[model samples]
Target: MKINTYIDHTILKATATVDDIKQLCKEAKEHHFYAVCVNGYYVALAESELMQTDIKIAAVVGFPLGATSSYIKVEEAKHCIDQGAHEIDMVLNVGLLKSGGYQKIIEEDIRAVKKAIGNNVLKVIFENCYLTTEEKKIACKLSLNAGADFIKTSTGFGTGGATLEDVQLMINEVHGSVKIKASGGIRDLNTAKQYIDLGVSRIGTSSGIQIVNPT
Candidate 1:
């Protein structure tokens, strides 16, 4: 398996600077990662740094907290695409999903962002650590129904990261309607391989270098 191709080399730190993004793009190009995932503000910088390479730039919307209005999320996604993001990883509204009010609202949230991004890849972050097993299933269904390209396991900022059990549950739930992205705690070759073995289409992590070339 080409593990590097499965990785979305990521740096979403709140304190990330332009230099950090430049270094990120450099490493991504050197390592031949599938993409570089960064915050929206730095998509243009990453684009400029990676324009010569085939590496895609993924931008985050709604980020660690998905409490923002759907309109805001749409705007964020549009702005990121405008700034040159080839893909978007959007946070699902944990509050709304937990509230159990109307599931359509959550679906609409994904749809709005997907619409804004057009053909760009859209991965919806479930932050599975905070959800129950049933909630996870519901989230998978909503994301698929809303046209998400991938269903992500976590935000890496959540209390817990991707787990084998969660990935399995998601795989069973989505049933290939959409691809899966296992993020968060994937920091080693073995762990990353484990998720890929479990059928994740992508691995989102800050440890791409470590996973591909461990000490």
Candidate 2:
């Protein structure tokens, strides 16, 4: 399979500069990646750079930590979409999920964001490192129920990144209703390929260039 099509070529570092985002957009266009995932602040810049191309712009909300209020995340999603973001990869409220408020709080949060974005794609980040197997399953079910387009594994700024087991578990739990995105710590070709082999529909990482053209 063509690996480039599965990548959400990403650069979400706090230190990322305007030049960095420009370069990222350039690289994504040249490589024909599925999308260029960037911080919400750079959505406009990335959009300006990627205009006229088929490449998509994906903005992050709630980021590495899902501790922000749901209201804030929804606002961020709206602003990014207005700035031309085609997709949103939002972090789920891990605290709410672990506090036994999974259905009431977390699910509602995701649903609100989905409604705000309307027809745009929404990928809910679970930050899987913080959950147990059962919690992961519950989160997957909640994401699908909440109308998420994709159930993402990590934010890449978490304690750990994606794992094969988490990818498989998420895929099995969603049962094809929602897509799976494997992100974080995927630095090489073999690791990325393994996740794809397990049926992951998208791969999120800053190492997209390396994964596509490993030396």
Candidate 3:
């Protein structure tokens, strides 16, 4: 399989600078990645740098922590789209999910954000590291019910990254309704391919180059 098409080249570190984003876009252009995932503040910069390319710009909302109010996440999603973000990877409100409030709140929050962005792709990050098997299933169900385009495995800033078990569980739960994005600890070609084999439609990693060229 062509690995480039499955990758979402990512750079979400707080220390990332303009030069870093520039280099990111350059690498993404060279590798022909499916998209370049970045912070909201850099959406415009990344868009400008990738204007001539077919690469899509993905902006993060609620980021590593999903505790922000739903209204704030909606605003963040809207602003990112305004800045030319073609897709959004948004963090789910972990607290709400864990508090037993998920059933009522989770799907609505995702639907609201998806509606705000119009036709832009929406990938909901479950931050699976903190969830139990049952909780993960619940989150995936909520995401699908909310009409999210993809259900992501992790935020990468969480206590842990994506695992085979998590990916399997998510895929099994979501069935074939929504696509899956495996993020977090996908650092090399083997790991990347493993996720692909498990049926992940997208791989989110800062190690895109290493995975693409493991020499």
Residue pairs clashing, model 2 = none
Per-residue lDDT tens digits of candidate 2, residues 102-164? 577888999999999999999999989999998999999889999999999999887999999
lDDT of 3 at 107: 86
Residue 203 in model 2: lDDT: 95
lDDT (Cα, tens digit) per residue for candidate 3, span 1-215? 99999999999999999999999999999999999999999999999999988999999999888888889999999999999999999999998888885586878999999999988899999999899888899999889989999999999998999999999998889788999999999999999999999899999999999999998
Assess every candidate by TM-score. Answer: 0.99, 0.98, 0.98
* TM-score-based ranking: 1, 3, 2
Query: Candidate 2, which ten residues in sequence have the lowest lDDT sum?
Result: 95-104
Mark the 10 consecutive residues where model 1 has the least summed lDDT: 95-104
Instruction: Write one digit per residue (lDDT tens) for candidate 1, span 57-146.
Output: 999999988999999999999999999999999999998999897699999999999998899999999999999998999999999999
When sorted by lDDT, best at the front, the candidate numbers are: 1, 3, 2
